[model samples]
Target: MLKVLFAGTPDVAVPSLRTLAADTGHFEVVAVLTRPDAPTGRGRKLMPSPVKQAALELGIPVIESDPSEESFVSCLKATGAEAAAVVAYGKILKEHVLDALPLGWYNLHFSLLPDWRGAAPVQRAIWAGDSVTGATVFRITKGMDCGPILAQSTVTIGAHETAGELLERLADDGSHLLAASLEAMAEGRIVPVEQPQGAFEVARKITVEDAHLRFDVPVFAVNRQARACTPNPGAWCELHADGDANGEPTTLHVLAARPIADDDRDNFATMLANRAGNGDADGTSASSLNPGELLVTKRKVWVGTVTDPLELEQVKPQGKKAMKAADWARGARLAPTAYVK
Candidate 1:
């Protein structure tokens, strides 16, 4: 059996640790390396990373020291680990730390090699409208996720899947891929192949500003933006009373949304015009809903985009709990011309 050291931090990394620990016949997880406890929650109490918690449950030794510390290399050498497996460890491994193990470290990245290489592959893939994305297990080199690939597995992105939902699936599926690659490495059955050379996209970490929704963009673009940021720096927009430029804008978090079909858009527009008694005799007009304009009915809420409107399914207003979009509109008692910016 190959003795392995595991390095990881988030909940996404837990599955691979569990898989390797359970496969006692082929692998023995000697120890786990993870980030130290950090402040979390509203109360700001320090809490251990998910990987550290899992390691404790599995009765494995854990090293939470920074890799840059001089003693970190010594601590790693003491674990008697032959190689290391990493998943979202959230730290750079310098040459000295890499040299501590006999076999080089392998990292499980949540994207195909040479694509979406960076800190936020999953979110970037969704934001870029990638129809398919996958995981790659590669030997860790000095460059960021630029190592040779040992194995890869692809999965289709759902039409309306949010980054959080897609990431959850990838984490579960990629755990098996990581384990298989390590098993092949142990048996000397696999060779790492260099990634293809070419221009590729980098998935930089998403920031709070990146999650702000732009209603001026096309409906599909708006939909993608909202999905890409869901459940994390969540998609948001500024809500102000119509023509209330001097009023303080409320931040509205869009939890779920979808593009309105052409027919549905027309129907909604006509309904709004009829409610306001502003349409022609046939309740039809050549005018389109201006971007950011809102049309809220008893059962639904739609916001205009460049091309069409996006239906808001769930939303949270500033300092308010999440609720159905229609419910929020009703409670706020917004004007007929209310819109978001």
Candidate 2:
């Protein structure tokens, strides 16, 4: 059996660690390296990383600390490990640490790379409206995710998939690829493929600004933002009362949404034009409603955009529980001409 050291953190890395630990016929996981325990949850109690918990359960020695530390290198050297595998380890390894392993280190990154060659690739792919993304097992080099490929597997993105959902699928798929890459390396049947020189996209880390939703853009773009940001910083838009003396705007967290169909969108435009020209049956000036105007009825809540109006399916208001958009709109008593910022 080939002895190996495993380094990873987070739930996404758990599947890979489990596969490597369970399959001891060809590989023996000598030890696990992960981030130190950090506070989590409401009580702020220290919590072990997912990889650390998994390793402990598997009866493997676990080290939770910075891998660049000299003491860490000394401990790794004493493990008699021939190789190391990394999956979302969350830290860049120094040259000295890489030299500690006899066969160097391999990483299982969640992207087809060369493209989306940074953090938050899966989320960025969805935000960019990409139809496909995949996992890549590569030889770790000095560059970030710019390493030579060892194995790859692709998966189609769903039309309305959220970042969290896509990551769950990719993590499962990546675990298998990581296993295969390790097996190939052990059998001497693997060759690293250098990434080609060309234009590629970088998936920069997500920021708070990325979650702010703007209604002046196309419905598809807004939908993409909602899907990409759900279950994280979360997509949100500011709602103004049109004439609030205090100038306070309510922030609405958009959890889920769908772009209207072309035909339906055309019909909605016609209806809005008529309402703008003539007072609506409810004696409200729908015509004065701007592109960012919000409408609420018994069934749903709608927001106007550049192309078509987007239906707000799920939303969360400040200091309130998540509820249907219509319910929140009704409770707020939004007027027909009320426009969101």
Candidate 3:
């Protein structure tokens, strides 16, 4: 069996660690390296990372030290591990640490090699409207996720899948890929392939500003943005009551949304306008609702976009729990002309 050290931190990394530990015939997980305990929850209690908790359960020695420290390499070498496997370890490993192992360190990244190579590949892929994405196990290099590839597996992105949902699936699927790659390396059956030279998009970490919804864009774009930010820094917009532009704007969190079909856009707009007593005789003049305009009805709440309107299925008003969009609109008692920005 190939003695290996495992490095990971988040819950997503737990599956990969478990997979390698269970495959005792080919690999031995000598120890696990993870981030130190972090303050969590309302009480701010220091808690062990998911990886650390798992290592304790598996009876593996745990190391929670900074990789950038000068002594880290020696510490790793002391574990009697010939190689290392990393998954969301959440730190930049220096050259000396990367070279400490005889077989070298391999990283399982949640994107195809040379594409979306950065901190937030899964989130970026969904935000940028990627139709397909995959996981790649690569030999760790000095560059950020720019390592040579060892194994890869692809999956289709669902139209309405949230970033959190897609990441959960990728984590599970990639666990098997990661375990197999390590096995291949142990048997000398895998060769690292250098990444192709090309312009590639970076998946930088998502910020709170990135999660702000732009109603001025097309409905499809708005839909994508909402889905991409779901369950994270969460897509949000400023709710402005009619004739209250100078008042404090309420933050509205968009939990779920769907674009109005092209064929139904005109009818929906006309119906809303008529209900608000703002439509002309033929209703054609009121068919074009301004972007960011709100059309709240008895059952649903729709927000206008550049192309068409989007139906908000769930939303969270400032200082309130998540609820159905229609219910929130009713309780808020917003004016007919009130809209979100």
TM-score of each: 0.96, 0.90, 0.94
For every model in order, what is the number of clashing pairs? 0, 1, 0
- Candidate 2 achieves a global lDDT of 0.83
Residue pairs in clash, model 3: none
Query: Which residue pairs in candidate 1 collide?
Result: none
Residue-level lDDT of model 3, residues 51-129, one tens digit each, is 9999999999999989888788888899999999999999998888888899999999999879999998998898789
Q: Which stretches of candidate 1 lie over 4 Å from their true place?
A: 261-263, 279-287
Tens-place lDDT digits, model 1, residues 111-203: 987999999899999989999999999999888899999999999999999999999999999999999999999889998999988889999
> Who wins the TM-score comparison?
1
Q: For candidate 1, what is the TM-score? A: 0.96
- For residue 221, model 3's alpha carbon misses the true position, in angstroms, by 1.2
Q: Which candidate is the best by lDDT?
A: 1
Tens digits of per-residue lDDT for model 2 on 262-331? 5554445545656567533344322333567776556667787776678888988887999988788778
